[model samples]
Target chain A: GAGVSQSPSNKVTEKGKDVELRCDPISGHTALYWYRQSLGQGLEFLIYFQGNSAPDKSGLPSDRFSAERTGGSVSTLTIQRTQQEDSAVYLCASSPESNGFPNRGETQYFGPGTRLLVL
Target chain B: GESVGLHLPTLSVQEGDNSIINCAYSNSASDYFIWYKQESGKGPQFIIDIRSNMDKRQGQRVTVLLNKTVKHLSLQIAATQPGDSAVYFCAERGGLDMRFGAGTRLTVKP
Candidate 1:
């Protein structure tokens, strides 16, 4: 079975430029999540989408960060006016758990991730 | 704000030896925990997981122990091999989010 997939394995951009990272979740995976990992740091939750409901954006570091999962499958994380500090590996994952699941800890399959470097 | 943390940032073991990675979580509400391994230039791969109700779970050459009373978790790998060298992370699930620890880098020396 095909796993989650992300685009632009590596991206280098100047500060203040906007970048869009894409994620394609596995077929029938209702739960999708985005995370950021800085150099030598842990994974930082960014946003999550379940079915067609509103995405959880609580973990977004700032207002400049936003994400949208269109058609409940493909998600895109947009960082506006990117800062040098925004440089990190952007990871995407998906799970088969539905909205009615008792817990949100379902197994997550991750993509290779997009490495963004903001200069 | 809840967080998961590791006691050691790195661990080294001889090939074929056993290795243990420990993690501490602050959120008592956490009901599920997971361990992941990430190699260089790659995303994390799920290793094993355990619900709060279960104290221990086992998989091939791997074991996950969760102690909710003490908010502690550990992953043990038996007969560690060179392929086992990577960054291992522990994640605690609370509410609609899961928090991940900084991860411990394991090195299997042959």
Candidate 2:
């Protein structure tokens, strides 16, 4: 039982700088997802990875946002040339193996999240 | 370009009272719905979920109701407690990703 974990609880960086946020899913979780939450806003899907299948990057707002899950456990979300609009709480979540459809009752456990502030 | 949305942005209820949160989604194809509760400085925690096939689902002190015809969803908390005060969000999965609605902040008054 350790839930999902994210590193660098808070990050403040200059605009145009690159930042990398890391996430460690639950021990055996095979699905990892990244989301962004702006001030007073809801969670915005960024990307998702399940096992060895191709990562679903449809949610990525722009090409500057990218993510990778290595060895099927850890995932990193990298933002290149960050913008002030990218400032938000980046949340990571995980769940057990399923048909890739979260609607099927696969509960996603989330981490504390890494707050990013782009100056 | 469908999205999930909440009818109200805030709700206040007395402790031990029943609390109901409402949500509306635009995508008719969405088949799964979930409710999440998030406290300040924390990530969202799964509260309850309901499949489109079912009209209602109950768990613990929480119940989730889905109306496919109206594309509406609601989460009801029975005997609301102080611990239930938080921002609640509803999400719907239609395509490869799920869309989350702007959260509703719940305040439990003692």
Candidate 3:
């Protein structure tokens, strides 16, 4: 659409199960980011993808979290063996810059976010 | 630990009054700063941004000030209204890395 869109606006899964969240960024935005917002907490950076290159996975929180950007357009964040702590709102944002930005990525547009609840 | 914090987690301001939200970031290398507003059930929406090269930037009804000397950032909303009530976040970017602060809940009391 016109802005970033995230899938599974709300997900309820059992502990130890796996879940995948999707994101569709605005057209022509080369930079995409994933973040997690826990209850009564701030947004935590998860991953950053610039175009089709290897994404920055430093913020995945654990090895169970991984993400991939296909064709530099849509992205999916997969969490294996989910835990109660994984319950949070998964947010996605897109910009024209790579984080250290000036060309356009400086102002990122975020999605509505996916609320995940692990039982 | 790298973090961004605020002295007050919540602020109440009267309608039509000016509101100022502050942020203290721990990263000294951070050179770019941004302010975002996130309403309930919504993601953060960009407000304004200032680069390390400059200290201040102004936008529609909003202004962002960056004080590198003390590692502080502030957002000023002119004529604050009920529509401006939301959670405000301060984010910093350095060397291709971006981070967000805890955030401040702004309540515009009408």
Candidate 4:
């Protein structure tokens, strides 16, 4: 079975340009999460989707950040008017359980991540 | 809000020795704590986890201790090996959010 994966392992763009990062969760995973890892913040959860329900976007830093998951399998995080501060690694994770998760707990398997650099 | 801290803290330990990495969390409502390991240029991989209700939980070679009172978490690795060398992070999860602490870099010397 394949684990989580992210496309465009490395990306570079101008500061004002927009960028999108994609994530493919494990098969049958009902819960998907997006996060940003930076030198100042470590790793911060950006948003998460449970099945077709609304995503939890509380962790998103600002209005410039947004994400959408389609068909409950793929997710894309888009940043509008990227800035140098937005240069960081974007990570994706998924689990079988949405709310309760499990007693033993369903570990959120992570992807290798896509490193974004805004010049 | 996200935490502001170091990119990585270095931890050097001799082989067969035990290593403990500590973390301080800001959110007090958090009930679940987890430890993750990240190799060079790799994403974080789950190592162990401990809930707030339990003060300590042990695995084959690792242990996670949570102190809800002070909002702190720690990961202890027994018989640290060269393979254990990596950056370790402690995360607090609750209310659909998981906040990761600044990672600690562990170097196991044979």
Top candidate (lDDT): 1
Residues A90-110 of candidate 3 have per-residue lDDT tens digits of 999988755454333377899
Q: Give the higher-lDDT candidate: 1 or 4.
A: 1
Clashing pairs in 1: none
Taking every candidate in turn, the Cα RMSD to the unseen true structure, in Å, is 2.6, 2.9, 3.0, 3.0
lDDT of 1 by residue, B38-99 (tens): 99999999999999899999999999998888899999999999999999989888976688
In model 1, the number of clashes is 0
lDDT (10s digit) by residue, model 2, range B26-48 = 89999889899999889999999
Ranking by TM-score: 1, 3, 2, 4
lDDT of 4 by residue, A1-119 (tens): 99999988999999999999999999998888888888635877788788755446788999999888889889889999999999999999888865565221247889999999999
Q: Where in model 1 is the C-alpha error above 4 Å?
A: A99-103, B1-8
In candidate 2, the residue pairs with backbone N, CA or C atoms under 3 Å apart (3 or more residues apart, or in different chains) clash, namely: none
* Model 3: how far residue A49 lies from native, Å: 1.4
- Tens-digit per-residue lDDT, B1-110, candidate 3: 12334343888999999999999888889978889999999989988989898988999999988888999999999999999999898888876677788788899998
lDDT of each: 0.89, 0.87, 0.86, 0.83
Q: What is the lDDT of residue A45 in candidate 3?
A: 85
Please report how far candidate 2 places residue B20 from its true position, in Å: 0.5
Candidate whose DockQ is highest: 1
Judge the docking of candidate 1 as incorrect, acceptable, medium or high.
medium
lDDT of 2 at B61: 98
Choose 1 or 4, whichever is better by TM-score. 1
lDDT of 3 at B59: 97
lDDT of 4 at A8: 82
